[model samples]
Target: MNTITDTSIESITIEAADPDATREFLAAAFGLGGRIRVRRSEAPTTGFRGFTVSLIVAQPSTVHSLVGTALAAGAVEIKPVAKSMWGVGGTVQAPDGTVWKVATSAKKDTGPATREVEKVVILLGAEDVGASKRFYLDRGFTVDKSFGSYVEFETPGSPIGLGLYRRRALAKDAGVDESGSGSHRVVISGPAGTDPDGFAWEPNPSEQ
Candidate 1:
């Protein structure tokens, strides 16, 4: 995936009972209510670019915990918890019911240890070493030391070494077939033409 520095937003989604609540949640979250409108609704609705809404609920107790959390945060509750046609859930009045989801999830974290892992430098493949350097330089990226034929670019807060590699070579390192020279081309876009390609990725607004 090509990631740009200062890319603003990528996607927006909403989920709610009244559509209006979804929109209002998004409005408060992104502060884009006055300008962009791209929400798709079965009824009257609204949308915002780079927004995504995902609604998931499990047991009634789980839903209550989520609702309680929201209420504790001073969020206005619209309805009491009850069993709906779908399952147990409740509707909350938001600035835009049609914008974002105001529900809880039935998921858990049963994975590995939650130890911190920093920096996610994207690996870009390049053909010409000098040309690739020049391309990145022209785009304002400061190149790290050149290792053999491969070159590196710095992305703030990235934990690993982010660099440009020979497509075939990197593929071999990752145990992927990279025999074809022109197999892949990774583009690192920056804001405007001045912003350098940085390796910072934030949480998607819709998920938040």
Candidate 2:
């Protein structure tokens, strides 16, 4: 799949220890509309998973609403909703151990709270951000933006967005220690197979 051109992650399949509970939690909390799939797996995963799925929305109210629903749906709050230099957001660990970031760029409420998600971003924590960025580019992923330690891929029309950041920095952003061993416990679809950073990928089922 090295020649993959004009690509985006169609969806991600999370290998859950408790598929049923995880599915229910996801449905009630974020209503991912099946973009997040689950299957049973006992793979050992601890601490940070080297990745996070971020929900970017239009306003702070949506962030509050989403975070509140996530907590009510059995997610453990990793960070309380608060304003940051970037905007407003928070973190939560799903019942199945997936770290999720709910965020918005707007500082104030645009209107009433609504469960609307503007984008679903999958950010991979890469050991060598520059190398990984180059790897993805060689695989035909368009660069939306890039800086010293971060790269965002152009994923137009994709249900799941893609980006890469320095591993240590990513952990800091997630408010977690950067020490963890074992599987990431998830597989995504963009370019099939694993990348240099060990992020797993499979053929997008939707394209089958």
Top of the candidates by TM-score: 2
Per-model TM values vs. the true structure: 0.35, 0.95
| lDDT tens per residue, model 1, 112-143 | 32212122234544545566567566645677
lDDT of 2 by residue, 29-107 (tens): 9998868888899989888889989999999999999999999999999999999999999999988878899999899
Give candidate 2's total backbone clashes. Answer: 0
TM-score of candidate 1 relative to the true fold: 0.35
Model 1: residue 91 alpha-carbon error in angstroms:
44
| Backbone clash count for every predicted candidate, in the order shown | 32, 0
Task: Estimate candidate 1's alpha-carbon lDDT, on a 0 to 1 scale.
Answer: 0.40
Q: What TM-score does candidate 2 reach?
A: 0.95
